[model samples]
Target: MQPIPAKLAALAQQENLHFLLAVESGSRAWGFASPDSDYDVRALYIRPSAHYLAIDEGKDTFEFIEDEWFDVGAWDIRKALRLLRKSNAVLLEWLRSPVVYAADSAFVRDLNTLAPQYAQAAPLLHHYRGIARNALGAMDLHGEIRLKKWFYVLRPLLAARWAVQRGGIPPMTLAELMADLPPAAVAEIRDLVALKSGQAENYRHRLSASLIALTKTLAAEVAALTAPAPPAPATAPLDALFRTTLQRVYPC
Candidate 1:
């Protein structure tokens, strides 16, 4: 709905970025944005075939700012693949973001079709480890109720569950996480989400029973997240596929 998104989309098109998808992926998307949160726009696109063949080191990601409150970033197709191999959840979510500024190609459609074949277990491990490390620290050090600290902990824990349940890597969001929790844990997460959603920073959010119950459930899930991932499915020639999609999207 913001004009900023439209401007950024135009910039991406001018650079021959061939937008495949774009979406809000920051504090706003997470539902806890401050009044002036930056429009964190992300997109994927293809460059000309010549750009691919005459490769400098393939830069996987790029950023730009059309103006204040309106910045943008893009990922190259090959760069996206490299991240996909390692299970980058942010990248996966970008592929699935709810907002759409500009998307005028079949490139991501083609890539999504190939995703099932190539997405593996290695990346999910890396993704969860980083999530736990980053948020667990905040939960430990921040005041018991700091910035809805529980979401940081819960997000990664549930995502780990999702990976195990689905038998392959899938992207996660807070909205979807609640339905899958044990009743008690769900209550705890709700308390946290309610506290965080309103942008409340109570020095101490005390939900005595709920907090304890949720942490226990999360601890168990964390263990599974650290456990070895199951094997990935067979690979097809994604390079050929990428090229074919590129030719079709980025003509001549």
Candidate 2:
């Protein structure tokens, strides 16, 4: 393991937590990372079985933030599975992120297999739209805008569009979403992406008509579409997996 991920794993081990899955989650994982972007490490962990027997359930999250190189946190597996059932877009992104640091292939495989079955368009659409809208709020129509906000907004909008069109989980990286954009917009995006790679996070670029227009158009389309009411998933399978994993990790 690389130094950063090794540190994350060792930290978990010290805490007596079993790391079920760990991967990059933010701009670094999204493929448009600036030279100084934070390495946002996210993971799902399983606690020792004895910890679950206590009357008070302990906190289910761990967070550590230092420099841009190592901003790390994790969700307990139980919390992660609950969020997954709700089709939480952030958790879904964690599962789909291309930069995995540590994972049990079987555990990752089971969750990936179940993701499509439980994922619904409504929650994901609402989640991504909120992200895009927030990003747009940070942008200026006629003045200098943070170059990073474009990716922050456009990436989620593109994911929402893909979910609306295809009714599935969108890919985690911005580059994957770029394939669906118009050629002119794509060109502009490419230039911005290149700039982001070389420049610092505070770097600002002049707002352009084409990028703004594209963002508005996609936002409108996403707002118009209705999320399909997906059927409730059978929880028995998830329950079994949860119990099985807990036992596997902390067996007698």
Index of the highest-TM-score prediction? 2
lDDT of 1 by residue, 42-89 (tens): 877777777767647656577887566766788887777766655567
Reference-based TM-score of each model = 0.79, 0.95
lDDT of 2: 0.84
Q: Write the per-residue lDDT of candidate 2 for residues 1-252, one digit (tens) a residue.
A: 258767876788778898889899888899888888878889999988887789999899988776657877899988988888888899999988999888988788888889888788888999998988887887775678787877788898899988888878899998888787778878878888887899999888886887767778888897787887767877787887789888887896
Error of 2 at 190 (Å): 1.4
TM-score, cand. 2: 0.95
The TM-score measured for candidate 1 stands at 0.79
In angstroms, how far off is 123's CA in candidate 2? Answer: 0.5
The alpha-carbon deviation from the true structure for residue 48 of candidate 2, after best TM-score superposition, in angstroms, is 0.9
